[model samples]
Target: MTGRPAPAVLPPSLRGWLGLVAAFAASVVAGLGIRYAGEGEPGRVDARIGAAVDGVGPPWRSVALAMDSLGEPVGAVPLVVAAVAGCLLLRRPRAAVFVVAGVGTAVGTATLLKHLVGRTIHGGNLSYPSGHTAFLTALALTVAMLAARRRGRGGLGLGGTAAALLVLAVALVAGAAMGWAQVALGAHYPTDVLGGWCTALAVIPATAWLVDRIADRLVDRMADAGRRGRR
Candidate 1:
């Protein structure tokens, strides 16, 4: 009997995925650019425009800013706790590495675009895409993906259901908090944050699927190798 390794197929092209990604990206650029550009100069989502009409002033604005600032740290706490627990239970040393890479690449893309766009920059406003929001979203989504994948393999269906719910809730809340912080802090226009989210998710879906597929293949390969070695 002849023995040979199976061919590896990294997804996307096999599923007409690349075309969809390109279309989505083009749409994001057009939609976000138009909405953000229409807003006129950028600064703290123009809280003053509506507030002045309402006759609101001072500490209220300050309070809003403070709340925005408060959200990031608060949201981050859940992720940190989950990550620590993951370390103890799953020992996935590469989790943080992949997360950092995804976030760093996303943030860097935002920062570069912010400068390259040549829009006015003050108080974090030269925004095509909001970096802070994107960073947190990337982290949140990545963790959620990891949690879901692990849950799928666990034998306890009830526990897995609970785990999946918890992961989804945390990721959604954290991601929303991050977006809220950017909007409240006047760090970016709502359009900028939305666009950044689109960009991040667009990159993420394909990458995440590929990573998961590759991981499964690698695990199978390693197990096969171990069995061969034993024989």
Candidate 2:
């Protein structure tokens, strides 16, 4: 029998890579719109969406609070640790590294964008790209990418297309959920959440690809060195 295929790592095919590039481009375009259209205040779009979502009670508020916590250090740390531990159990060291690197890069990008864009919501708070949304979306994207790797044929039997779609779908859903939570609680404008979502989308795929490239090269070098030593 043929040996099991290697882990998917990042996008496994040319089409997958193209799709990620398109996604990154789309995110950059959206971010540019937000940055130039209204740098420090809510635009018309943000006001309308925020007005619709801003106030709620009971179960939704409770749910939003819980979801919000997932992006915080208190909840985010444990979840990340669990993901890394699970990757080790599955013998996927590169994926474990990706889990850490991907999330860190996404969050850092959001923080940097917040400073650069200088969008504000509540009295001088830098809010253009919600860091909470970025964190949760990054976490979700990392998990989805790992799941794709485990499937062996680029996710659920559909090759690289399936893997790409799976990663994007998971990231989108997670970002939307967190975005809604942030809006509902009046923590951010809708555009701010949108910026955060796009930031993760723009950053994670690139981060995954970079991690794979660097890690693979290092592994190859190590293997060559070992062979030379044995010789």
TM-score, per-candidate, Cα-based = 0.57, 0.88
List residue ranges in candidate 2 displaced over 4 A. Answer: 1-8, 14-30, 33-38, 152-158
On lDDT, the leading prediction is 2
Q: In terms of TM-score, which candidate is strongest?
A: 2
- Please write out the lDDT profile of model 2 over residues 178-210, one tens digit for every residue: 999999998888877877887777777788778
Clashing residue pairs for model 1: 44-186
Instruction: For candidate 1, give the lDDT of residue 35.
Output: 53
Looking at model 1, which ten-residue stretch has the lowest summed lDDT? 1-10
Candidate 1, residue 162: lDDT: 54
